[model samples]
Target: MERCNHGTIMRVYRTRQLWGSGDDTFGRLFWSFGPSIHAFSRTVRPLILIDGTHLRGKYKGILLAATTLDGDGGLFPLAFAVVENENFDSWLWFILLLRQRVMPVDKNNNEFTISSDRMKGLLRAVAEALPGSYHSYYIRHLNANLLKTFKSQKLCKLFSRAAYALRESDHKEAMELIKAKNEKAEKWISEIPKENWANVHFKGARWNVLTTNAAECFNNVLKGARELPTAALVDHTRWKVQDFFHFRRKAEATWKTHLTHRAEKWLDRSCSFGSKFLPRTCSWNEYEVLSSTHTDSADLEKKTCTCGLFQTMGLPCGHAIAAMGLNKLDRYKYCQDWFLASTYRSTYEEVIHPTLDRTQWPEPSYDLLVLLPP
Candidate 1:
């Protein structure tokens, strides 16, 4: 951990007792990639996904992780903490540090969107640590909770449709279908805050991330190192992250398109879906996109479709695609800046440098001590 601070990698690693200089058991430790701070702050999207998993090792603890999304829609790990448990205090400690060092509070308005499965003590901690930021719940977790209340695959399917609905009308349609199946299911779904899972009501840019899967995917990547001791585990992570950046930096340099691969794929799919829809130009900038089942209004100037997907997903929806095709507009123009390959390449432009050996490390200005966990 000390070696990681060599040239500004921004890593935090410590072992503290339950009681200061008295307790034998260590409490918690946190780690983060330092250079990722500047890179993410400038290049990556403002979305954050946090999750915790139980460590199965000699020392039992919870591995809390915070991750972001790169321009190519890849996971960008930001910070991590190994705590005694996933509680309010533990989450608060990690989030506060994350805010101060990386995700700082914006004076204008909170630009960050944090997505989670609504873990124990997390909601309250986020409320306290980042009141300005938006909190979104993972739909899969919410559906799991719903299943606990009422058991049925049909209910889960309906709930998923409702959660994925991009327009208020579409959301209501799905909810109404669920209500028709069982009012209890509908009421149970309503109990959850709409903005937490409903894409149409979410306050910030979710970037199409509706689950905590990004963090989970990274956790899977670290599966082999979880069994190692603290120092080796951290070093393993550092090496893996460095290699990831190096490989992506080199691989993306040979790309052909202006947009990232994922963004281009999505655009292509949207164009295909649009081709199936009938588009009728109503005016200079307005068009009516009609399908057999649904009709949507599209405004090229506003960059919006009545279906709401165009504005929410930051990608041209089928309706918007059809309208753009009719007007001979470039579909790439509607994409967010973060979806560009240029931005994705810039995310890994800086490299993580090696650190000196512990014997050669500089002495600390002041000795830092940790208090025992209460």
Candidate 2:
């Protein structure tokens, strides 16, 4: 069989053309990732980013992933599984895989930080099962929804105001301001789905809240491939993702110092941090998504800036927000060597790896394979 290259990908089989002999038929493949989770764990640690993108195979669903915090531009795809849409069971399965990959080596929950899209069922499942550090949803996802909900430039201003405003009273004032301007917008209180509204606090409200941008990014990564078939979909994706991380993983020292320096700064601020500011567990709260007035002075220090970039990443997140809540400076950031991109990726003690799975039944030594001359 003679074949020319199919651009970057080599042809598997060819009769007429390298890519295909005017054929759609391809090979069956199960999606696999480079470097098993543990091997890749050598690359980064503590926090993991997770999201489920839609699948285009016989089993239509989403592919959820656990990846490293991308601070050092190190966005490697760690572990992935085919999930049936973005639901509870799907997220539960993803979390279980995450636990298996991380738990044995890293005892304390400190090794895992999750930045994902806001899917209530998934969060609920995570809370019940893993009950560890999961990141608040990224703001990019929230922006799209807000843009759609509030079309006019004037209304969008309100969304921005509500989003960055920290004072409980200010949140109320912003909401009231919106209601006064656009009476119909008042429906936001009742219309915004509760699950969607998690962690978001309106004035005079309290609850754990965050936007899920990481999930959206993962979804966007898949969007380009959604229409692709199973094999092409997986292969093309692997190359792009692997290529990105390969470059990122190489500059280990740079990323490590960047994150380490930043993490330490906030850790310093977080000290004398009463448990009130840092609750060990999640306590649900309700705050309306920022539907606020746009302002020019939204710096990382205030944390109430229009851009929710820091809030989204969740790593000590935005410097501005950190400043606003002096007590909670440490609480917001994702603490992981990987996020820090530090020299030490993780602290998983070097010990015999244990197989907690019942499936690993013992095998007799005599059962070992032997070769004989015939």
- Superposing all C-alpha atoms, what RMSD in Å does each candidate have to the true structure? 3.2, 13.7
**Candidate 2 C-alpha error for residue 282, in Å:** 32
lDDT of 1 by residue, 1-374 (tens): 53554323343433433335544345666777766777767777788899988888787778888998887778898887777788888899888888877774443227888899988899999999889888989988898888887888899998989888887888899999999999988987888889888988887767668877799999998898777776677777788888888988988988999899888888889989999999999998899999988989988778788887787767788998998887698888878778888888888887776656678777888985554332
- Name the regions of candidate 1 deviating beyond 4 angstroms: 1-26, 104-109, 276-288, 363-374
How does residue 228 of candidate 1 score in lDDT? 77
Q: Give candidate 2 misplaced runs (Cα > 4 Å).
A: 1-47, 57-59, 102-113, 118-123, 132-135, 138-153, 165-173, 183-241, 249-374
lDDT of 1: 0.81
Predicted candidate 2 versus true structure: per-residue lDDT over 1-374, tens digit per residue: 00111111112222222234444333212233433344344644445566666676554656665655343433445555654457675567557656654444545553345555566577686776676554444444555666687776666667556655554556667778878988777676446542233334422111122344444555676677776654456556565555554544444435524455445565455333321231221112111122134222223333332333334333432333333354343443434334453433331121112123335555555854332211
The window of 10 residues in a row where model 2 has the poorest summed lDDT is 1-10
lDDT for each of the candidates? 0.81, 0.46
Tell me the TM-score of model 1: 0.87
Which one wins on lDDT?
1
What would the TM-scores of all predictions be? 0.87, 0.49
CA displacement after TM-score superposition, residue 261 of candidate 2 (Å): 11
